[model samples]
Target: MSSTLVVGKVVCITGSSRGIGRACAIEFAKHGATGLVLHYFGDDETTKEIQTLKQEIEGTYSPAKVTTIPGDIADPKTATTIINAGVSAFGRIDVLVSNAGICPFAEFLTMPQATWERTRQVNLDGSFYVTQAAANQMKNQTPQGGSIIGISSISALVGGEYQCHYTPTKAAILSLMQSCAVALGKYNIRANALLPGTIATDINKEDLSDDAKREGMIKRTCLGRLGQPDDLAGPAVFLASDLAKYVTGASLLVDGGLFVNLQ
Candidate 1:
């Protein structure tokens, strides 16, 4: 009964420079992940914080190898690159946390085509490519098994006021996760989705800026406040670790009962 969750496991987390992605990377390392592939996207000048963050995680956790991988998730090849980098550095990829996503609040009628297309490309298409790459590796590897964690949102289950285009992408991921679970189960690959509620991340700061909009979410939540990045760290690690070996095609909500209390 070793309490460590993912000891000696190799994890790859996309969008790991900040926010929830960063939290997951740290959580896995703390829980005994031996290797980490931190995937990030930026101006290509080489993001310094990503490197600093990697150093801090590896130093704090000690004995874990952390590699920074930069690329655009929108590009199909980016998924291939991230997975390949992980395998090349760690010999194999044990878990993949597809946490890179975007939520641009926009009115349905006013939403530009570019906005819709980019959202589809990054949140849906990119996720599909990454999950496919990870699943294929898991299927062919000697161990013949691995876990895929798709970072979905509560918006997938419930409609949002301004997530007209964004919601669909998240919803698609849930469906995609289920499909992967069914198709890859024979290969021992587990696919699951995590639906986080209104989290206080820099990515959503503008969306939650309005006092009225912020309080509306608070009223629906069972917890008095919004969710923090740390709140999801536990759930993320559990899904990637042996503790959840039997779980697959499940969408676990880390949303303080917000969906349950939906009006």
Candidate 2:
């Protein structure tokens, strides 16, 4: 679909301070999302990034529109505040991307209860809170609906060596997307999950810097290359736009055929 089709639509992206979230926000803006609610968590540095992005958008687009909201998605009140800021600033929310997540690797035997709780709080609980808030806003919109995109991981589907605590939260996200899709279909709001494989994000580079580890990752993938944040941006745009209006409760895998090839 053409980018013009999504013109004037507003999109709220959580955890957009960096990595995949940041890339998604930029891509959405490029694809005619008129308004952007850039949500960051506990970071002052992101303010500068947001400002830079806003300037870039303004320079590139006819009329750039962007708003930044800082909050912890784990808190329901904060999530509500994010939704309200989007509505108050942009008048409406056309798409909500629940991308706020934390993945701290740990062996099941050695993982502490606190670690598990923290992971779930940010990944699963945060996703639920944000989706709830966005769905409420979307239901009341003149268009009477919007798209909700959950940023899940391929770890949700298969096992990883040292991510027991993190994987389950992602698994919960998939279920959350399905539940929301079923419950909100009547309201015309679509909910779906985007499952990305080992993308070259900063979080992964720290551990995968070794050649052996990097080689192993590439060997496992049918595409023979690690995924990039930009690689998944188009799919996200598609899901958010009218192009995927009939799609809901489905998990779209952007994993370079790794899962299928492994199976």
Candidate 1, residue 29: Cα displacement in angstroms equals 0.3
In candidate 1, which residue ranges exceed 4 Å CA deviation? Answer: 1-3, 44-46
lDDT of 1 by residue, 164-188 (tens): 9999999999999999999999998
lDDT of 2 by residue, 30-145 (tens): 88888999898856687777777777766776554888888788888879999999999999999999998887777889789999898899999999999999999999989799
TM-scores for the candidates:
0.96, 0.95
Q: List per-prediction Cα lDDT, in the order shown.
A: 0.89, 0.88
RMSD of each: 1.9, 1.6
Instruction: Report residue 126 deviation for candidate 1 (angstroms).
Output: 0.6
